[model samples]
Target chain A: MIEKKYRDLIDKLIQKSLMKKVSWNKSSRETEYYVHFKKGSFTVDNWVNDSSVYVDFTLRNANGIEIVSQTFEKESNPEEFNYLFKLYKAAEESYIKVDETISSIINELDEEDTVGKDEEDVLPF
Target chain B: MKRFRDPVFALIVYGIGLIIISFGYYFIPNDLKNIVNYISITGTFSSVYGILVAYAQIMSVRETAENTKLKIEKSNKRVMKILSVSDLSKAIKIIPEIQNYLSADKDESALMRLKDLKGILLNLKFIKDIEELTSDEKFVDALNELSIHSANLSKAMMGTKTGLNKSKIISDLDNIENQLNEFEGYLKYGNYD
Candidate 1:
């Protein structure tokens, strides 16, 4: 379930290995940064062509189960552009800091699933 | 524990102490009757023996009181359990909205996300404090990271960025939301297995 929501974001993380470039992808004229997970993804887009930036909150996997998927966009002011870079940096820093703890969570979740399965099979009812 | 604290148990213990003292009353005098200071010595000995029994009873009552205090503290551990994770869940659910608000060109809308984000962050801190108080080690880091991400994101929104850092913000929100979801799960089921 979790793997599905963040699939694209996770896929993009492959670029992290190619982090040799310290600057933005200026040539592409579009700078996008995002995080994906089980529930939904929030994307902030910087469009060089239009010289505009906005953020989109896309809810996923919440189809009939939960309608957490209303797409909301907020456009930014040019003066606020630099803050996006800072926010992204902060996000990255926070992620790296807790990376180990996150791994432990996966382990714990696996343990829970394993235990649940074991119990489910044995319950007489 | 209840039995130990009961009046019935106290009576029984007191009765036994009396019985033992009664034996001393007879035995000590019998062996010492012929001695010069026997009468005085026996009386003093029996008195001292009775005092010892009474002292023992007092000590037992004191110890019981201390145990009861400890029991109350044990019950206090559950106080933090009452700090519901539902609030935390609700707070977590707002991250995407906060992200959406961050890009708002209108100060009112953008400022609104800051306030909402602050409220959620406050809730997160509250939950974290409760977890910390209880020494709940499972999801503290996750909760803290969620708060940090939201805070940073909110701080970023505070500026007048004409463009959202599209690629990373979406994925960042996703990642943080997932972490919060994990925390919610842990709150619900992590105690098991």
Candidate 2:
């Protein structure tokens, strides 16, 4: 059994999953989760009926082309939860990492702009 | 009060009186002159002592007024900074939402919320700056503690899921929320206990 804390994390993941652009095939009764990033997106395709839960974690390029896909069955697979949790976390970290990187770049560019302003104050001679 | 408060004026008056007494010495009868001399000498000493005591009292009152003014100014600054509790309360309200976004894998939204939080913290930097400038050690230390916790929260928010300690994040959030609540209470009721 996942701890209450991990369960809560899972619950939150589900909430976000509900928000992302999802693709549903009525004939197959399959729902796909698409979480977008700057360079790529993570997609979770979940197929569920009364008896079993099947899940897939797919990495897609910026254009939504699938680059990789891993499928797991709930009854047959215990490692699915671990992988799901990892991807959820990786998605979070990558967001922060990308933001921090962009912020630093902006800061550097600002510093350079300030330097340019200072240089403008000096005579060419 | 004005006459006695001026030491220079008091001294000038004493000098003129002494000169008058000296001039009157030659006019007095020989037998009464000695008695007049004694009275003049005693009266001069008493007048000088009175003037010195009055000057000391004036100086002390001025010093006390200056000290009171300084204390009032310092407390006024403290009250001004404390008044910013409202801003802090608003900032505290954003933490939970940031956590929600981060958990749901909404990186851009979470980052946006984090940026908002960072801006709020930066706005409150003036309070820290004032506390440091005034050498209000107790308040400066408290503000420093807040800054450290805020940095930790930002780090945890940006940290990876595998490495993330949800409990720690929750605790830190609790600590920050509790602190802001305390600040608000203190501001409202003027009670620190």
Candidate 3:
């Protein structure tokens, strides 16, 4: 009986992964996520009839811009949930890395603008 | 009441009586020529008294007006100075790096310079706002250059954290200095006119 239950769990994990795929795009200063349905009808009626699971994610930049995205799949299982969680973490790390790189570039330019000036000379009038 | 009490009213009544007496003298027979001359002299004296009273009233009004004008000018100067000081305080808060970069001596010098500027602005003798300092063409040009410099500085500050390009910072400081120099020249020359 334990062997049968383990086989069932492995089958369910494979079924979930084959059912959904999450894809994302960055454009116009925003990021969007989409979940694709790999099986069954693509019509609205089919989507409405399907059992969907939702995943939530957040992205933040150094300049304090934050974006939250949510996507829904018709079916999800525990194994798929674990995989999605890992993907979400990786995305967040990439976003912060990009934000920090931009911030450093801007700071460098500011330091160059103040060279060779006597203390008496820096009033904005 | 005493005859000469209420000096203003007394003078008015005395002048009116003198006019009546002079008229009566004119109508009297030729025997009253000496009386007519004496009455005319009295009328002239009373009119001179009324003229003195009117002169005093005019002088009082002039003095009051002058005092009021001086007070208004002083109040205006005080209000303007307060506004300028408030603005300066805000500017300093927005740019706190100014305090970090200056040496102790330079900091004191900057403080004293600001104090002197405030004194001139508050001195009721100077009648213009600091913003008006840019009215001169040279000052305006310098101010525009300063704006560009500040923009550059902001961009540079936004760019790097470590190993910051000091040359860009120095250039921006130079721009700011040039603008301030122009402003000071105009101020020292009393260019408000």
User: Using DockQ as the measure, which candidate wins?
Assistant: 1
C-alpha lDDT score of every prediction, in listed order: 0.45, 0.53, 0.41
**Model 3 misses residue B118 by how many Å?**
18
Between candidates 2 and 3, the one scoring higher on TM-score is 2
lDDT of 3 by residue, A5-120 (tens): 43363344334434332222221111212111221001000111123433333222211122222233425444544444444334433434555567777787678575355777
In terms of TM-score, the best-performing candidate is 1
> Which candidate, 1 or 2, has the higher lDDT?
2
Residue A107: error of model 2 in Å?
A: 60
Ten-residue stretch with the least lDDT total in model 2 chain A:
A21-30
- Model 1 earns a TM-score of 0.42
Clash number for model 1?
Answer: 29
Query: Which of the CAPRI classes, incorrect, acceptable, medium or high, describes model 3?
Result: incorrect
Model 3 spans > 4 angstroms off:
A1-125, B1-38, B97-142, B150-167, B170-193
- How far is B10's C-alpha from truth in model 1 (Å)? 5.7
lDDT of 2 at A79: 74
In model 1, what is the error at residue B74, expressed in angstroms? Answer: 4.0
Candidate 2 CAPRI-style tier:
incorrect
Model 2 stretches with alpha carbons more than 4 Å out:
A1-125, B1-50, B115-175
